[model samples]
Structures are given as C-alpha cells and as structure tokens.
Target: MTTGIAARIADRIRHSGPVSVAAFMTEAMFDPREGYYATKNPIGAGEDFITAPSVSQMFGELIGLWCAQVWMDMGQPARFHLVELGPGTGQMMSDMVRAGRAVPGFLDAARITLIEASAALKMVQGRTLTPMGVEALWLDRLEDVPDGPAIIVGNEFLDCLAVRQAVKQDGHWHERMVGLDDDEDFTFVMGPRLGMDADLVPARLQDAPDGTLVEFRPGDRQLVDVLGRRFSDHPGRALFIDYGPAQSEPGDTFQALRGHEKTDPLAAPGTADLTARVDFEQLGALARAGGLDVDGPVEQGRWLKSLGLEMRAAALIRSAPEKKSVIARQVMRLTEPDQMGELFKVMTFSTPGLPKAPGFAPEA
Candidate 1:
C-alpha cells in the first residue's frame, strides 16, 4: 500500500533535494499529520514495537520504587516533578505511582508530568493514568515542564529521536542523506565531506574503514544537556533505559519496524516506525559536561536482578498461585541474559551532592 507520506516525501525531493536521514525521521515519526506516532498507538502485540514498561507491571513498579528512593535522596522534596519522556500509554507512570505508595510521602509529593508528543498516545495515557488518581500534565517537550526537583524516566525513548549519519567515502566522512532513484524509490546518497572539527568525528573512529557509517544524535545530546542543566540548576535526577552499545562504536543502527518486525525503512515513510540505537557513551558524556553526576550504563538484566526483580516476581506469583508460570515468564523476558537483559542498558544522572540511585551501585 502506497502511503501519502511517501508521496509527500517524494514531492519534497522533487522540489528541493535529498533529505538527511534525520530529516526523514523527523517527518516520518513526528510530522503531526500522518506521522507514525501521530496516527497509531504503536505499542503492544498489535503495534510496531514493545518497550520494557509494556512487557510487565514489574518494570514500572520497580522504576516507581527507584523514584521513591530518589525522592528520599533529594531530601524528600515537598513538591517535585515525576516526569516520563515518551510515556507510552502511561503504564510506567501509573505503575511507578502505585509503587510509590509504599514510601512515605512519595506519592503525595510527586507531581506527574508526561512529555509525550503524540496526541493519540496522550489520550491513551490519560485513560491509563487517570484511574490511578494521577493528574498528569502532558507536554510535547521536556523544556515545557516547569523546573523543580524532577525524577525523570525514559524507557526506550532515546532510540526514536532523530540522528544524523556520517558515512565515510574515499577516506572522508560525508553526511548520509535520503534521495530517490530512477524508480522514485528512496536510497542513501552521500553529501559533502565534513570540515576539520576535532569533535565532529570521535577520535577512535577518525580512521574508520571506508563506507563505515557513524551516527551522531544532536537532538538526544541537546535533550540530555538540557536535563543535566535542569538537574544542576534545580535538584533532580534522570534515568534512561534503552537498547544500544555501552561504548561508542562506528555503525549504522538505523532501521524501520512494522508489526513488531523489521521492514524496509524506505518502503513506507510514515507507516513504519523508524529508530536508531541510543549511544549511551555519548549521552553520558554530555550529561556529565552539562553538570550532572553520571551513573551506570549497566546491562538491564544485571540492574534489574540487583533491584530484586526475582523477588518481585516471586511475590506476585505467591499472590496468585495460578499465574506463577506467567509471572515467571515475564521475569525471564525482563532479566534473562539471552533476552532483554543483555541487549538493553540502564543509566542515570543527578545533582552532584545526591547519593547514587538504587540498583546501579558499583561493584563491591
């Protein structure tokens, strides 16, 4: 099926010129009109992808418990923002709030704010969170949230942010762009080589092999910088969990997803979900430079196990004996080394004086 967005992009190319991968992604995922998230729920078994929060109640509950600890660490701030970026259907927020009830004053002190761009998802989030007595204020961007001691959570959020890819051609780095072929199909084309900027190419990949693609996420960096600055100015911390390499590497991790499987990114512009891997190393560095204390980019499995996910599962199973196998499966999906445990990573940043967040302690 030919998508209107595909034709629209083609028209853009015919009028102007080839667009960067970042540009294509920006419009494809967030155009506000016929964009992927703007149109579809895009989560769960029927959607393009599934995030950690969607996997089980345990993920959200644990995150909530973590936030409660963070709140206490921040001296039990009288009023603080409990923010979640890209809060799909508000499952995480709801779970976190529910779990926060275990901690004294955590629930009462939290002012829920969800930074979600999609209106459709926002409606879903409203329905999901409202029942939990959460009066969540929705905003499109992080900057929109008023400043305060905020406990920020972003699960599977960074990967969707637009990223620019620089491809090496003839031993020089040129920006990669999306252009059309004779059949009007989209294909990658190289633009002008980069100028001499020490920061442009990471020192490790300066002599990268020809045709190698290295992605740079300016948007993600900027957001992290903003969050760091917020933490510096106000007193807060932010946690991020996503699938990506813990260290910087040279490769193109951009791809498209449709119906929970890989699809041609160029095949359907607005119909498929487009994403690139999160570069945790880069994000961590930016957060540190922006003035927040950085934490582990540890493997998700290890981190969760440290947080007692096994015990949490066991408790849930004990509560409902018949659901023991189901609960066990959820635990395995979240923490098994061969599953999300190894692929996904967890990291965080906070005000300088704050103690380390739970479940991310350094080795004893």
Candidate 2:
C-alpha cells in the first residue's frame, strides 16, 4: 500500500477541489494505507505525543483499580466485557489485566475486547496480551462488541475521532475549510455555512469575535450515544481520560504533533498526529439522552487525587527509596496542576441502574 498520504491528498485536491479541514484530517489520520498511527508508533519519545499508559505503569494500575471497583459494584458479573476503545500497544489493557488479577475470580470471569482501528497496533497488542493469558479480540468499531455487561475505557480516544472547524466572521459562524491560498498551499478558509444547529450555539459563544476559530466534535455525541445505549441495555460503566477543557469553551483546538513538537497541521498529511481537545459538556447531554448516568467534567488531577493517587504514590515511594523520586514525579505528572493535571480531564458514564463509577462523582 502506498504510504504517501500527503501526496494522495494532494491528488484528491487536484482532481476535485478544496476540501474541508475535517476531510483533510479524516484522510490524514485514517486513510488506512499510510495514516500516521496506522503506519507508525505515534506515542512517546520520537513520536508525536505521549498518552497516559505511555507515561507510566502506575497510571494504568490506578485505572485498573477503578475498573475493578466498578465491576465489584456491579455485583461481579459472571461474565463481563472489559472494553478499551483504543488499546495502543496494548499497554493499558495489559496493565489493567495484571492489576485486576489481584482480585479473586476477576480474570477468569472477564472477557477483554479492544476497539482498535489499526491492524498493525492489534498485532503488537496480541504479543502483549496473549502472554498475560488474556483472550483478546480487536474490532474497528464499538458496536461490534456484542451487547453485554461492559466496563469501557478510552484514554485519549475521543480527540482523534475527527472534528469540524468553525470560525466566527462578520457576526456569523462559518464552517472553516482547507483550500489553496495565494501560495497554493493548503490554508484555512471560511464558508458561509452554519453547523448542525446554530440556534443552540452555546450561550457563552454567541459573541464569537471575527477571526476566532473554534473546533468541535459532533462525533463525540455519537460515540457517547453508542456507549450509553450499549451500557443502558446491559448496564456498565465507562471511564474516559483526555486533554481538554472541563466546560464547553470555544477555541481552535486542532493541533498536530511530530517529533514530540507542535508542527504545522497542514504541513504533512498522514505523517503527524492530528487531534483536538474533547468537550465533556456536550458529551454529557448525549449520555443523558441515552438514558445513562453521567458524572463529572473534572480535572484529571482532582479525579486521580480523589481516587487516592497520593496514597499510591506515597506507598511506592516509601517501598523503594531509589524509585521514590520517580514515583513522586509520575504522580505529579498525572495529577499536578501544571502538567497533565489541569490540561487532561476525566469523565465517567454509567448505565441507568449502575452506581457512579469511582474517580468521578456518584462515588456512592
């Protein structure tokens, strides 16, 4: 398969015309033949960005504990689906299964299902999960999981689902698009078109000043709806962790990363990690509409702290003096104010009958 995504995109433009920024992003990240993640590792050191699981093992361990608590709260179902929306390198799922093994009868009773889009990543996952004695299966879509009691986890998943950009101009919202500028390189342009619904534009954003561009994920609502409906039928909980604003705010969250640094998003299609921040408020409505329980839009710092990350950090630091500082720093990175603490968010959604999952409200 040709790995020249940028070239393929250029060809499309030459054949047709300018495309929307969303269309460019969709092709760049998901073209399958040579998309960024589909072709290479986009996490950690030399790549575009680092996710939570890549940050440290402790991060996954803590989430594992949270899932365990959720499962136990659900009365320890004899058969439950442990679904991870994007099991990159299978690290988080592997760490989770390892931690869950501490609980009696947990591993034997659980079925691991990974919602992954790349066959390359899935092969890597098999090497990791198979050794852990986990029977895992990967699918590109969540709906294929076959409805059941599920505990869902998506670390940095929603942001990459693709988003549309809208820039307020002349006192009205216009869908931002990608077109050939005077230089003939891709540049942003605004179309005199409104989004799905303009009347319901957040009250706070009614006065969007001209030239101020904002990005949003209509897909987030659809994802929430699917998970909410699935869990509503079987009754489960989902934990989502990602970088973004807690409340709905407007900004051009579209960003690209290459070599661990910010790059021109238009510079290289299918070669950089293109992403945007998540909007939890909008997602809350979707979950609610599906008749599920929703909680939080909390900062990752507070959520992890509330879930006892401090105690875990302190214990590990105490056990090994040599690794104390390392443990402390990881905890800070995970929950401190300046790092991922405020930038990243944690939200939980549960079925109608399920109790509020830990790490968020409904701690009942």
Candidate 3:
C-alpha cells in the first residue's frame, strides 16, 4: 500500500524540486500526519527493529548504575534532571530507575525528563512507566528539558537524526538531494558543489576519490552543541550510544528498514525507519568545541564490560538459574565482539570539573 506520506512527499518533490536528504528524512520519520514513528510502534517482534533495551533489562540496568555513579561524581545534587532522549516504550528508563534506586538518594533527587517527538511513543511510554511508579515529563526537543545538574542518556537515538550526504565529484563535494527517478520513485541526485571554505566536508575527507560518498549530521552536531553548552553552563554529564564508526570515514550508511529487514530507502516514504550511522568523531569534536570534556569513542563491548556487564548477567543468572542460558544469550548479543559489541560505540561528555564517567578513561 502506498502510504499517504509517500504520496505527500511525491507531491512536494513535484512542486519544489528535489529536497535535501535531511529534509526527506525528517519528513519520512517525523511527519505528524503519517510519519513512520508517528503512526506505529517501530520496535519489537513485528516492528522495524529492536534495540538493546528491548533485548534485555541488563542493558538499561547497567546504564542506571552508570548514571548513579555519575550522580555521585557530581556530588549528589539536591535536584537534578535525569533526561533520556528518544526513550522507546520507557523500558530503559524504567529499568534505569529500578537499578538507580539502590544508590541511596539517586532516585529521590532525579526529575525524569524524556525527549521524544512521537505522540505514539509517548502513549506507550506512559503505559510502561506509570505502572513502574515512575513519573516523567516529556518534551519534543532536548532544549526544552529544564536545565540544571543533569545526566542525559541517548541509546540508539542519534542515528535517527537527519543527516546530510555529500558526494565527491571531479575532486569537489556536492550535496546529495532526493529527487524522483524515471520510475517516479525517490532517488539521490547531486546538487551544487560546496565552496572550498565550506565547513560541511571534514578536512581529512576533502581529498577523497571522485564519487566518494560522505554523510554528516548537522542536526547531531547541533545536538552535541546544545548538550555540551548545557553541561558547560550547568555541570552535568551526557552519554550517547549508537551503531557507527569511531572516526570519520567515507561511505554511505543511510538506510531504511521495515520488519527488521533492509528496504529501499526511497520505495515507501514514511513507512520504513530511516537512519544513518552516526560519526562519533564529529560528535566528539563538536562537544569539545562547545567546551565540554570529551571521553572515549569506545566500542560498546569494551565500555559495557568495563561497566560490569558480565557481573550483572551473572548476578541475574544466579537469581534465576533456569534462565541462565537465555540471559547469557542476551549478554552475548549486547557485548559479543561480532555482534553489537563491535558494531555499536559509546561516547560521553561532561562538565569541565567533573571526572571521567564510569566506562570512560582519561583521554591521553
């Protein structure tokens, strides 16, 4: 079935010509009337894809412990914001709250804030968190979260932010735009070449071969700036975990998924989950430029292991011996080098005076 959003996007392209990839993505994913996220639950058995939190409670619990430690590192502020970006179904937040409560005043001092754009997910989150006795306020953007001493966590969130793709041609870079193919389907077309002084292309990739595709997320950089400024202005810490490269690399990672399978990105707008790999290197640089102390863009496996994922799994397995194998599989899925462990990465930033977060070491 042709989704209404697909028709809407076609009409837009016909009227205004090709749109930037970022523009297309923003509409495809967040369009209020018929966007993918706006209309349905995009995670779980029959959904688009599943995240770590959906795979196991252990993931969120460890994050909770990490937050509690960060809270202690910050001297246990009397009132602090514990904000989560794109909290899907509120499962992770619920798990985090349960685990963090063990840290004496952690939960008592926390004011939970969730940054989510989907009204659909908000309803699901309400149902999931309310029964867990967790109270939270929601905002459509990160900036809306009242700022103070805060601990912000974003898991599998940054990749969803719209990213601009540029293709190198004749030794110069041109912006990639979404246009209609001969079949009247969405396709990537080259736009104007960027100026020599354009800040969009990373310096190292400027000399890339002709036809090289590079993707950058201006929105993600802006988000880092916002979060970094928040931490710099008011002491806080932020953690971002997502699947992407540790350093800037040349390749096209934009993709669409439906029913956990890859789909043609332009085939059916607003019906598939669209995303691109996040560049942690760019994000780290942005955070540093914004005056926050940056930490490792470490592999998720190493970071999680450092945070004691194995230990947590064992403790849980001991409690439910019969479920040992099941729990072990979940841990493996999260930390196995061949799985999410290597594919996903973890990075963090904190206020100048704050110490490095639990899973991160001092930068050399």
Candidate 4:
C-alpha cells in the first residue's frame, strides 16, 4: 500500500511526470519529515548496515593518529579545525580524540567540527562524545564549517551523495528517471536525451554500446569545488575512506540496505540506506584541478597496515589476552583482501607545499 515517503514520492511523480534518479534519491534519503537519515541512526549491527568505525576502535584510533600527523605537518598550528563528515554516532571521532591525546596538545589546539544532516544521528553522536568532554560544532553541510587550517576526514560518507544515472539507448544517452509501472510500483525509465553541451558521460564511455548505464554525482563536483577553494586559501588536508574502484568504470552501483541485507531500492522508499560506489579517480582529478595535492586512492587494507593496524591489534591483544581471537578477527575483517580491505579505498587531499599525509607514500 502507498504510505510514508513512497506515497509522497508516488504523488510527486504522478503529478509532475517521471523524476530523475537523483531527485528520487534526494527525496527518499533527505526529505525532512520521512527520509531514512532524517528519522533514524542507520549504523551499528542493529541498523541498516555496519560501518568500519563500529567494527573496531582500532580504525578510529588510527584515523586520529593520522590527523595528528597532518596537524604536525601543518607546522603545528596553534588552533586548527578537526572535522569529520557524516560521523556516525561519533564512534570514530571518539576513538580519534582518544588517540590524539598521544600527541601532546594536539586535541587541545583543535576544534571539533562535524557535518551531519540528521538530528537523530546528531543526538546519538552527542551521547557518544559528550562523556569525553568534547563539545562539537554540528553543521548541515561541509561548506558550513568555518574556514581555517583544518584536518578533515570522512568514512563511508561520499557514497551517500545522490547520483544521477544515464542509460545509452539507440546510440544516444538518456537520463534515467523513476516512474510508476502497471502495478503502480516505482520503475526506471529513460527520459530525454542529454544535450552534447551538457553531457557529463565520461570520455571513455562515449562509445559504450547501447544499454550501458552510468552514474555520476553532482554533489561530488560541488564538494570538490568547495574543498579546492578552501585549500587554495587555507593550509589544510582531508581524507576520505569509501568503497569503490580506484579507476573510473561504468556500471550501476545504486542499491539499498535494510537490516544488513540488500533490498530492492525502489521497494520501500525512505526505509533503506541508499548508496552508490564512489568514483575515486574522478574525485582525485577534481582535487588536483582545484590545486590540491592528491594522494593514493589506495586499498584500505594497505593504508591501514601502513598506519600500524597489526601493531595496534597486538597491543590490544596484550592488554586483554582473553579478547585475542576477537581482535584478530577484527584485524582480518579490516585488512583481508576478501573483506573490506580490498573493497574499500582510501584517499587524501592536501594543500600544495605540504608533504604527503600519514599512511600515504611519496608520489613517484
């Protein structure tokens, strides 16, 4: 039966014809009253899906240490911004804050900022961080963060940005839209052909045979543009960890997760976590164009190891010998090629004239 956001979306489509995939995703995920993120905290084992921070404290600790190193490279700014984008329940930030203590004055000289759109999740983050005496500044967009020397990090954040899909048909690319089927269920349909001047299809896919579907995020460009400008004027660095191929490829990566299982993205609007694979190559190019030095879209496993993942696991096991097996499993899950290690990628962006951030090797 039509209800909740599904009904709202159906009504909109019925009234105004088909909606682009980007518009559908924006409504289903960000609608103020009934959207998935607007209503619930979709992290942890009990929620839609688990993030790396929830998997282990080690992940967050390493990230914290990484930021500390960047802060040091920025000539130990007396005060700098330590920002996290889409901090889920504040687990990573909490861990990072704890780890930052190892670097004397690092936390003291830093201002904690979080870019979170969901009030529900913000409450959870508050609970997770308040005990540590961290009073964070929460904002709705990355652009809202105050300008200054900053160390920014985002884990599994880029994938949530809405993406538009275009399908090649009859040697022409048409924007994919969401429309109602015979059963009144949402379905994908081809819309108007993209004009050559406005075409954003990757050059490599220009001749892809008919029926090849491609996805692109307008938010990605806007985000990079903002960061490029920020880094151009300020000394700072940003790190992003997400799942996607290191190189750009054409495919439909849109899907929904509910209760840790994949579900039909169009089945229950605003009831599942919608995401698409990040295009790291594209992101890196944008960062470079924006005048920032870009680093490895490296495999997560390799990046973590370079930051001492195994060493941290050993230290944890020694402190709590009884939890050795559990710690070992977490290590494997975070670093093994078959698990998140290979699937997830890590990339960093830094202002020019600064050395490569921690965990990333010197560019050849």
Per-prediction RMSD in angstroms? 1.5, 2.3, 1.6, 1.4
lDDT of 3: 0.88
TM-score of each: 0.96, 0.93, 0.97, 0.97
Please write out the lDDT profile of model 1 over residues 1-364, one tens digit for every residue. Answer: 2888888888898899998888999989998889999998998888888888888999999999989988888899999999999999888888888888999898888888999889889989999987888888888889888978898999999999998889888878898889999888999888767666326565567788888889988786778778867877899989999999888899889999999899888788888899998888888878777777889899999998888898998899889999998888898899888889888999998889899889877760
Best by lDDT: 4
Clashing pairs in 3: none
The 10-residue segment with the lowest total lDDT in model 3: 195-204
Question: In model 3, which regions exceed 4 Å deviation?
Answer: 362-364
- The lDDT-based order of candidates, best leading, equals 4, 3, 1, 2
- Tens digit of per-residue lDDT, candidate 2, span 1-364: 1347766666676688767777989888888888776787666765667787887787787888888899899999999998999888888988888878888888777888999887778888899888888888778898899767998999999888888877787777888877766665677766656855554455456687887766767777678778767875786888899888766788877889888889899886887888888877777766787777888878888888887778877887788879987887788788788899999888888877677678666451
Q: Distance from true position, residue 318, model 4, in Å? A: 0.9
- Residue pairs in collision within model 2: none
Per-prediction backbone clash count: 0, 0, 0, 0
The parts of candidate 1 lying over 4 Å away from their true place are 196-198
Cα deviation at 223, candidate 4, in Å, is 0.6
> Residue 30's C-alpha lDDT in candidate 4?
92
- In the range 66-178, model 4's lDDT, one tens digit per residue, is 99999999999998899999998999999999999999989999999999989899999999999988979999988888878999999999999999899889988999999
